[model samples]
Target: MPQANIDPAIKSVHVFSTGAGEQHKEHRYGSPLPRLLWALTSQSWIKIPVNAFVIEHRDGLVLFDTGLDPAIKSDPNYINSAIGRFLLRRIFRLHIGPDERLHKKLEAMGFAAADIRKAVISHLHFDHVGGIADIPQADLLVSKDEWAQLSAPHPEREWILREHIEIPGAKWRPVEFAPTDDPLFAPFGGSYDVMGDASMILLPTPGHTPGSMSMLVRTGDTPPLLLVGDLTYQADLLMKDQVPGTGDAKLLRSSFAKVRTLKKQFPDLVILASHDPETADILAASHSSRP
Candidate 1:
């Protein structure tokens, strides 16, 4: 039986990157920062589209990341947490109108947030999981170890939140892939295969954080798409093998290197970068019907 819920006509698919800013506007374009870190990307902010995905397979539907907090659009300067949030909308030169939240967009497309059965997180960063609250019935997926790390985090680790992880009444499913150092597909080795449905697989890319993952969507036996969350802020950087501009240079460096190799090996995979503007172009072109 063809899955009635998921639009199977769109066999292999992707979601567009929605955000409020640009990448390396300081470095490639021009800004007032002297060092690469501050110049390339804001350590305190990023103008990235929370890249999310929706996959339709024979059995079910799978969602990638949930995206940024809809609240930011209301009060682009509303980061009332302890660490205090950077006004990304202002920093990115984005003017968030009242109507721009993921759920709004989803509802507009004739789908509700609760319709999502599974969601794969690249990492637990706020921008990635900010819309988690909007997704009511999803079996939220992330590395089990990563969840632990997010909860019992290292000191001064100003990113993740316990509330996001332990949302009351949410169906959170922690997935682990450490024991199997096997390649995501087979023969190759390094991640966990979400054991087919042509659904989603979680790659164990632990660098952007302790359990960063790149989502692999298998539409068919011949090809797939790789939605890497913050793996490389830009696909151009990953293609160039250049060390990415990240919070921790060294950690990001190592992670960047591995993904670079993966890209080299599987060039056919449709790759998406959360903050990269290019992803919007690619995804829009791929599924113009939805956008």
Candidate 2:
């Protein structure tokens, strides 16, 4: 079969690894017994990359997620509360360095932190929003439901830390999805067109967190990409309707079904997850395949 040409207007798409870390398999899969057993007997850890996607849109530079902050590993006060710190260690293992900071990573990719005009936040998880402070000038967009969590007392309990998100001088914009006439996005019920050109469309996927979202990127020369943030540890799992250990399983299933429908509609659609190990290689292939 002949290959399809992608949008020439999209200069390039780049993926950066903010850091590399590992989490218990049980924490990634489901159920409490396995996690307890692993805590007691096993030492298996699944390596995953904390990733952020950068798109070279014609209008400006846009980021899918901000990735992680190196401070989490370097600073003792990163988590703030002692209890939070204790829980964090029990759940995962992080291996990050000073050079892995968002700004530095962007610099390594030939982009400046100031070049990011818009940032689509998948959710308020500390790992995803860790670099928001690095780009205070960028318009940070988050779903209204996700932003609402910040107003509740101690959102950090749910991993949505206000201390990092509510930082001074940050441009936070909470957006609501509107009905879309486009059938391609009909499964999502509504969509938010980030660039108003169908180049990047934001669809609410929820499940992992109340306002979790996935980004649909369409370029003339490349297959559409659905950047799902922590929706599932892997894209294959999502296709099989395997819900992760964290998050609302029912909601995850509902979101998973919607994503499956999207795949049915656009078979070549690439679903990119935040923690997926293949994101870097897949993104590189996408770029290489571009016209």
Candidate 3:
């Protein structure tokens, strides 16, 4: 029962939360933004939480985004947080070095490194890919556009690709989500049945990072859960109609529109935040099952 996302046989299933953690560093770097941003987001100041959601499917495991890795796991600098003089380097995640890991948790649930079918990265960012090594056998499923945007000769953020994007081992499967299911996009879009009735629908909710994507999880006749990656850092922000840390103004607005629509369609659906402690609590309580 714990191994499947749904009733297993009822509809093929597999989705994992991997683990949960927190981040308290948004105020220092957030204040410089235009007043309009603060006015729109109502978050001119405050440290925020960074969370990671890992999903498992019948054929593979889809990681919504990678959170802090081993580097930050044992870093003394990150252990202690102060109000002033916050260290950015201490906050930024690094490529997982060794030892500190999430594999043990997965193994405890009877899963092996090779058990992961695919690690779908919502976008190319360190926090989301920190646990890449945890699923060595799985191919890296990422959006070609996202990769292109990050790996472009002149990328917007250099740190996004630095080693994490171009890693050793594992197969990299780049996919393009389609608006109408072209050969390239159909396989990547709509609701994807993992193992059971549980599905991860890749909604093209760009704007957060050009190629940013969000997922919809349906299970147990329960309220659907939408994993909106990085679109908004805080769940309350979405619930309160605020803005996120970073996103193309227009694109963010478009995605925000989707957010409102989804909320209306599935009022009971849990709209999760990747970097919100409250969301992590919800995930731990609601989605604690290994499957």
Error of model 3, residue 291, in angstroms:
20
Candidate 1 positional error at 197, Å:
3.4
Q: What is the lDDT of residue 190 in candidate 1?
A: 49
TM-score of 1: 0.75
Per-model TM-score versus the true fold: 0.75, 0.93, 0.69
Of candidate 2, the 10-residue stretch with the lowest lDDT total is 1-10
Candidate 2 structure lDDT = 0.85
Q: Could you tell me the C-alpha RMSD of candidate 3 in Å?
A: 7.2
- Global fold similarity of model 3 (TM-score): 0.69
For candidate 2, write residues 156-274 as lDDT tens digits.
77878788888999999999999987776787889998987777889999999999999988876777788999999888999988888788889999999999998888787788889
Write candidate 3's Cα lDDT for 128-155 as tens digits. Answer: 7767766777777666667777657644
2 versus 3: better lDDT goes to = 2
Note the clash tally of each candidate.
Answer: 5, 7, 18
Q: Which one is best on lDDT?
A: 2
Off by over 4 Å in 1: 1-12, 17-19, 22-48, 73-78, 86-95, 153-157, 181-190, 221-223, 284-291
